[model samples]
Target: MSIRPATSLSMAQPTMEGAGVHLHRAFGFHEPRRFDPFLLFDDFRNDDPAAYANGFPWHPHRGIETITYVLSGEVSHSDSLGNTGTLGAGDVQWMTAGSGIMHQEMPKGNAQGQMHGFQLWANLPASLKMTEPRYQDVSSGDIPTVVDDDGTSVRVIIGDFWGKTGPVDGIAAEPLYLDVSVPAGLRKRLKVDTYRNTFAYVFAGAGRFTDASAPRGVLLEKEVAGQELNIRDLSGNQTLVQFGSGDEIEVQAGPDGIRFLLVAGAPIEEPVAWHGPIVMNTPAELQQAFDDLRNNRFVKSAH
Candidate 1:
């Protein structure tokens, strides 16, 4: 029953991606080793149609899983396998680009031209890197949301929490993805697997994730209650809060409350050979993937 201490904390960066879509990049395309079994996380939020209308054109992915969760607006997607669908508010699509797949996502803003969503990339292990591609699309209605008596709530997206399992499964990472919300001035603790590498991304509201030593965690020192802390709120966003080896995390929400995603997974610990969007175990395997793509034989027949 030991509580883990906060090892390091840093905020995400404000970067532009996907044909001029302005968003915050939590981590990606640089030093991917810090977080094993996880590759990239993009916070694509916009309030203008012109900022996200162009969207992400067709792109290829292999040896990985891309999870897209939509908070508001809609994202219509199409893939090379002839699968197409529209993800509305609160929906999530987990696409496993095992062998290989080409897909496109175009975001259509709502009545106010406001769109918000998140996409997280998780790497597939060498064994399942070339498996057949598949999709797990979970609608908002199907996702279970549990509210506690203290006004704290959690929407289980993957793995298990609050005695509920997320709809997305069969993943190699065996990860736990949770959307947690704690009411103003409330303290909450969640249990995590001791062997898993866990971190939390605060996207809405504000909160302090602290250990027994640093009970106050961090304070932006200036923002009013309920407003989104900007990048300058270094004490708030961008800081990656890494925890020690423990099985539970304690967090206390600010006056305005807090909402964030808590994710954890067992480290692969194998060599990572990544280029562009493809991740393999070795350089030779990476070259082979490119060769297969050039020869038009990226996908193996489902047996």
Candidate 2:
């Protein structure tokens, strides 16, 4: 199997959003072509309640799908359609804002005042942009977790993995979203469809992603016992690793092991006109969406 080379590495940038909710953005608002079918990704993890308590107030979203996975604490959300729910640790909520919708998400910290989660925005193809809005809230217990013989673990969230299918289905992007943890000092290779755009976001511990095409001298190197050692090449926490074309990705865990989100999706390859949360194909269509919001006609099918 061909190992996908690490094309680029970047650290998540600290950003403030939704009434001053502090978070880190891994990728968004730029370079849409690199991650087609996926628009933005945010790592909203905070220990100070004041930093995240304000939460994402009511906002409008159109022509996109949002996937929110809670790692700690709880997120209570309500939408313009009168749908409301609370997502606890390990729970996931996938919301598709087809025509348009207004929603609000309020985060409540855990006992230790820690709130951690991720929000990914996926673009809907033009055919589905004007479809109906929908929600698929999967509880933690309902999602499947697969454990390997070598102590590696994987949580399949959106697509099939290790012969197991995720709880949420009927997604436009047909993406594979996995939460993977490798044992310390273990080297693991994971398969990914060759036609999809793939990226990994490291959130815990350290690891090294093997780039078959990179020259031996170019990677970050260190010295061990009077010998050159290429160790801990990956920056670990909040680091985004984008991969090149291939069918598999290889990662070697560091001394403390590694945990990350491996996400891949088929590209839509369509023109994107994005303004805030609303995404469309043409600028004029985006303007019409705003005009609809101003005239109280944004929600086409609120059910």
Candidate 3:
């Protein structure tokens, strides 16, 4: 099994969004082609209520899908289609803004005034960009979690993993989204499709992503058997690791263990004319989307 090397590593940048809601953006609004078929990812984890209470007011989205996974607290959301719901801890909401849709998300902290969750934006192919909008709200209980003999656990969210299938389906990208936790000091190798662009976001604890040919650096771990081997720096909370092509990824958990999100998807390989929440193939199409919003015809079908 080929081990995917770490192509790049970066820390999530602190940013403000949605009426001053403090969050960290792992990747977005820059280098669009680097992460094809995926637009943006935000870690909206906050412990201060005032920092997130204002929440995201009404916003328009088109030609894309938004996936929100809540780890703590609750998120109350509503859309222009007259759909409303509250996503509690461990809940997930996958919303496809095919034609167009206006929605609002308000976050409510838990009893401890702590709110933790992630939002991922996936780009839709040109063929399905104008399809009907839909929503798949999966509760925490419905998501499957698989455990290995070594106490490693994986929560399969959007694709088949460890012989279990995720609850959400019919996505154009057919991506694999997993929440993985490894026990302390355990080295684990996880399989990934070589055809897909893969990335891992470390959110809890620390770990080292082993790449045999990685460049030498102060972060490098000890050489094995006195042979020249390169290991990536220990990745801790809010770190993003982009992997090179391979069928598997190997990592060593630190003392406190590690918890991270491993996400991969096929590349769209098409021109991306994007502005704000709307994405299209060309500038003319992007302009037309805004014109539709002005003409009060953004929502093609409301169900």
Candidate 4:
């Protein structure tokens, strides 16, 4: 079993979105090809109600899919297609804005005004870009969570993990999205498809990932996982770890344990022309999407 080293690693940058809602952007709106078949990943975590209550007003999205996973609090959403719902804590909503759809999301914090969640955007292939729009609203109870013998729990959100399949389906990327949490000081080896592009995002706690060739014990914080190890090493939060060509990954949880999202997908390899929520293979196609939106002919009838 070969282990691949991590490539691009960076701390989540502070960015505000959705009408002044404060959040952290892990990666997005730049060089979409580096993470092909994937577009944006935003970590919307805040303890202040005023920072998130305004929420995202009505916005148009086309040629892509948006996955909203609520770690805490609730989000009430409605779309132009008349679909509406509320995502409570641990709930997940996968919306395929195939052609186009105007949507609005309003987040409500808990009694203490703590709101935390994540939203990831994935791109659709050219063939399916103009398909009918659809929604997959999976409640927390509907998702499959598996616990290992070592007390590591994995919640399958959008793809296959640990012999279980997520409730959301019909994705163009054929990606595997997993929320994993490990107990303190436990070393775990997880298998992944060798052909897919893989990356892990540390959301809570810190851990050590083996396979990088940058020398051992030279712990890296805020960027790579190795630079200088210390007792005060809580630097993995919001850090992205991209792996090289490997079929399995090894991770050793820190004393405080570790929790993260491991995502992988088969690259589309096609050219990407992105403009906001719209993505196309060529500039002409990108312009066509805008034209369709301006003419009110984006969403097509499925029947």
Candidate 5:
């Protein structure tokens, strides 16, 4: 029942991607060991339609899985395999670009000119990198949502939580992805697997993660003079909190409550050679993948 301490905290950096679409990158293209088995995370939230309307054009991905979770907008997607669909609010699309696949995503805002969503890239292990490309689209109603007596709500996206299973399964990484919301001024303790590497992304509101050596609560908003807290306090939107080894996490909601994504995964402790979307074990293997794409042999598996 050890409580994980916040190891690092930072805000998502504003970055332009996907044909000039504006988005905030929490972490990506760096920190291999920081969040192993997970390669990238981006927060595509915008209130102005012009910022996201350009969308992501056609792109190829290999040896990775991209999980797109939409919160308020719609993401229309089409892949080379003749798969096409639109993800509305609360919908999730998990695309496994095993051997290879080219896809495009176009985002449309709501009537109020608002859009919000998240996309996470999980690395495929060496064994499954070239298996076959696949897609899993789960709608909002299919996702399990649980509410606790303390007003803490959790939406299990791709793993076990609160004795419930997520819609996504058979993943090599065996990751746990949860969308958590804590009510105002509520204190909650959530249990996590002791062996998994964990992190939390605060998308809305603020809160404090209690540390073993810190005072009673995590005060993320204001700093009091002479505060004898030896713990990390996390707050504000787009804040990323990386946790240390522990079996559980404790958080106290601020006056506005807190909402964040809690993600954990077993580290893929293997040698990694990564270049863009293609990840392999060696440089030669990466060159081989690029050669295959250039030779128009990217689709090795018949969809």
Candidate 6:
């Protein structure tokens, strides 16, 4: 068994998007290869209503899937396909922009004037790029939450874990998304597929993802608990921790415990021509998408 350690950690950056809402951008438009099959991650969490009320207006997306997970506030979304709905606390919306789609998302804080949520962009492989646009709206109650005896809870959003499957399926990336919480002083080893690239975004508390990646079938059990293989600086409030190749991950929570979203997927390993919201395999294809938008030929159909 190999333990994957944190390869890189970075804090989110404050940026304005969609009209004028202020949000933190975790990663985007730079060094995207490190996060293959995953394009960007944005934290739209805010305590002030004014900072998020403006929200994201109309936008276009193509050759990608956008996953929105709401934590405390509500997100009212409307797409060109005539789908309109409100996502309350703990709700998730997985929208696949196969060929093309335009949508808008407006956020409203809860009673206490707080909004917290995340949006992750997953790149689609070329085979499914122009398939069909669709939505998988998952409610909070529909998601399964598993609680361990040691006060550790995990909410599986996609893929199978602990004998339970997520509601969202048929995704090209076949990603595993989870919301995890570990109690103080608890050490846990999360299972991960060695074939996939994995990452964890810590939004609450602190923890250290031990750095002990063993090559192939080598067994280094003692190195997992040893100081030589531990990464001491992976605990950041809004940090993104990218892991190396390994079958499992070990995290030791701090006094406050740790809560984060663990996401992993198979790499696309294809050329990415990204321009704002549109992502294509080639530069010419990207230009054609923009040209189609200007000529009213972007979307394949309304429904």
| TM-score for predicted model 1 compared with the true structure | 0.92
Model 2, residue 13: C-alpha shift (Å): 0.2
| Deviation in Å, model 5, residue 118 alpha carbon | 0.4
Q: What is the TM-score of each candidate against the true structure?
A: 0.92, 0.95, 0.94, 0.93, 0.95, 0.92
Q: State the C-alpha lDDT per candidate.
A: 0.84, 0.91, 0.90, 0.84, 0.88, 0.87
Candidate 2 Cα outliers beyond 4 Å, as residue runs: 215-234
User: Per-residue lDDT of 21-83 in model 1, one digit per residue for the tens?
Assistant: 888888888877778889998888889898899999987888999899999999999988888
| lDDT per residue (tens digit) for residues 84-113 in model 2 | 999999999999999999999999999999
Q: Model 6 residue 115 lDDT?
A: 96
**Model 3 lDDT per residue over 82-188, tens place:** 99999999999999999999999999999999999999999999998899999999999999999999999999999999999999899888999999999998989
Clashes of each: 7, 0, 0, 6, 0, 0
Candidate 5: residue 146 lDDT (0-100): 96
User: Which parts of model 3 have CA positions greater than 4 angstroms off?
Assistant: 215-234
Candidate 1 C-alpha RMSD relative to the actual structure: 2.9
Pairs that collide in candidate 2 are none
Give model 4's TM-score versus the native structure.
0.93
Q: Which pairs of residues collide in model 4? A: 218-227, 219-226, 219-227, 219-228, 220-226, 220-227
Question: What's the C-alpha lDDT at position 137 in model 4?
Answer: 94
Cand. 1 Cα-lDDT:
0.84
Q: Best by lDDT, which number?
A: 2
RMSD of each: 2.9, 2.5, 3.3, 3.0, 2.3, 4.7
**In model 6, what are the clashing residue pairs, if there are any?**
none
lDDT of 4 by residue, 162-223 (tens): 88999988888888999999898888888889988888889888777776575242122434
